[model samples]
Target: MEATPRPSINIMTALLLLSLHGFIGPAAMAEQPSISADQASLLALKQHITDDPEDLLSTNWTETTSVCNWVGITCGTTHTSRVTRLNLACMGLSGTLPPQLGNLSFLAYFNITNNTFHGSLPVELSHLRRLQYFSVRGNFFEGEIPPWLASLPRLKYLFLNANGFSGTIPESICNVSTLQTLDLSENQLAGTILPLIFNIPLLKVIDLSNNQLSGAMPSSVFSESPLLDIDHSSNSLSGVLPQNICGNLPNLQGLFLSFNQFSGGIPSSLSECRQLQVLALSVNNFSGTIPRELGNLTLLNGLYLGVNNLIEYGSGGVVSTRGDVYSYGILLMETFTGKGPTDEMFSGEESLKRWVKNSLPDAVGDVLDAKLLSREELTAAKLECVSTILELAAHCCTELPGERKGMNDVLAKLEKIRTVLGQM
Candidate 1:
């Protein structure tokens, strides 16, 4: 009879148990949302086959997690959830760039410079509309630059230097009106400079050095903007340089045109750029008297007019052989003190060389940069090495060009000094 009443299996009780199971079962476990397309793109990059695999890059990469927490992935300043900068410079990463990087729509700065990356630049990068600073220099990338690069409306800096890239720089590069810096130096690119490059309204820094380019120096360059620096050195470019170069560029600071065939009178209008700091025109065919107006450039720090047919003039209206020397002395002071010359004698070639040579005997505490002087904890051996460097520079600046050591010798001496310093 008790079996008949068996557990009193009431329907209500069974229903209650079922309801509890529904609310407290394994099926109730929370599931994260699947990785978005942007995250998937990043994951694909992690799978790239590298010649020398970096285990550190893969330690925390996972499909279901936020990439913002990944190493080397810098997040946005305002919104930490989005990646803004990707700096993998000098990481020894070797692989074709994965197109998946374009998925990072908010990325503003991306630098993979000084790596072993090889292969054509992926056109898919055009999709990163917000990119501002993009640099992949010193890599083994080979191929024509994709024209799609010009389509990035927000790009401000682009550097593809020291790569194996071959072909003329695309004219479309100049179409990015907001570009502030563009460096395509040390490549196999050949052809005339694109005229459009001079037309960019915001371009401030440009380096197209060590290429096979040949043409007349564009007069329009720096004609419309406050370009601060320009380096077209070591190209086959020939012809007289543009006049009014510094006049047009009020903020012109550094100008490098060394190792070219440019010939003509130095532009007198250069004095207009009072902010000029470094002017390098060495190893060219420029002739005529050194513009006395150059002395007006009070902010000038490094002026390299050597190896040219430059005649110096003095304030007394006499042609002075010390003119070139004077400029060199200014540069020496700039390099040594990190400051402009305190007196005109420091701007004279012979005077500077003599001063440097005589000062070597008592050089330790006073001759060195003041900033470096504050380090009283420096060892005697370290001071000796630094004094040796100064001595070498002094020798290199000898009044007689033939007696002066060559740059190669100067560099070797500097290297030896560095080795000694390193040991100390």
Candidate 2:
């Protein structure tokens, strides 16, 4: 699980909080402060918090003090001291949100992440017109995500991950034009994902992983979407992946579809996802030869094809004697460079083959395994033989499948190199 992140506050708000409490409070001790509607709403919310072992709210939220001075409260500087942000993330508070909180018209950011908050989301939250960021993630919230969430006109980031939200995701959520990130992972959400959700104009990240969602993904064209990362892994989804999955999502970077019942050949068109860095298709019923075109994605750092029915392919996209040569070449590089193809260091236009190719022939020693070079009896002949092996690996890893050397030729070269080393 990712660590809960703190929301960012403006410098002006920080300064205002400091000035009101640090400097002004000492001089205004004798004046009487009146409670506003925002204050009443906050106090009402405080009433529902059944557990506060730290006495955070009991000691700080008092009738005598201005609500602006309360912890997790930030009043807007221009909205006549109206509460604009309430962040109680990871505070260990347990409670349900009060409907009265919807009255805070100026609220733009609200977060109660990693808390024990339970019960379905209050429908009153639909009235938060100015709200931009809302997170109730890592909580005990249950029931279906409300359809009224689409009513928040300005909502941008919506996170409800790691909860008990069930039922089909409301298709009405596609109405949020300004939404950027939507995460509903680790939930009980079911039903097929609607295609309109993928066509949301500005949506960049969509995570629906670890859910009960089923059915084949709609074959609709995802046009004009700037989506960067999509994780639909660990679901009951089935059917062949869309043939034109990358046709419209030009900025797609991560495609994680593991642990599902998806069948049929992996789409060859996926190679068009030029920005793709992580491609995970493991633990599925997918069968057929792996696409050789995938080798063209130099930026790809992670390619997981384990626990599947995929097979190695030879030239012209068929299983043959040369089918296993490409993998054997990668094995040679791995043995020499002491690096796997998916090593963290080989991201963004770099791979085990590319790394070795850059330092071949003359500088091969630099990329060679240290243990091999450290042998006291190792001679220049063995070093040259290693260089020859890496050169063979380069031939096998050519971007075009037909250009790759056949397994027969590769084996013949390796045998000659071994014979030469033995004579030395």
Q: Name the candidate that leads on TM-score.
A: 1
Least accurate stretch of 10 residues (summed lDDT) in model 1? 26-35
Candidate 2, RMSD to the unseen true structure? 15.8
lDDT of 1: 0.74
Tens-place lDDT per residue, model 2, 1-424, is 9999999999878777877777666544422232377888889999999988788899999988888899999987775677899999989999999998888888999999988999988898888899999999989999999999999999999999999999999989999999999999999999999899998889999999999999997785557679999999889999999998988888999998878999999888999999998887766898988887898888887676645676664445555544355655665776688776667787532467788998888888889887456666557778888889999988876766678787678879989998998898
Off by over 4 Å in 1: 1-35, 52-54, 76-80, 221-223, 312-393, 399-424
lDDT to native, each model: 0.74, 0.84
Q: How well is each residue in 275-310 modelled by candidate 1, as lDDT tens digits? A: 898788877889997787999999886677765677
Residue pairs whose backbone atoms clash in candidate 1: 325-349
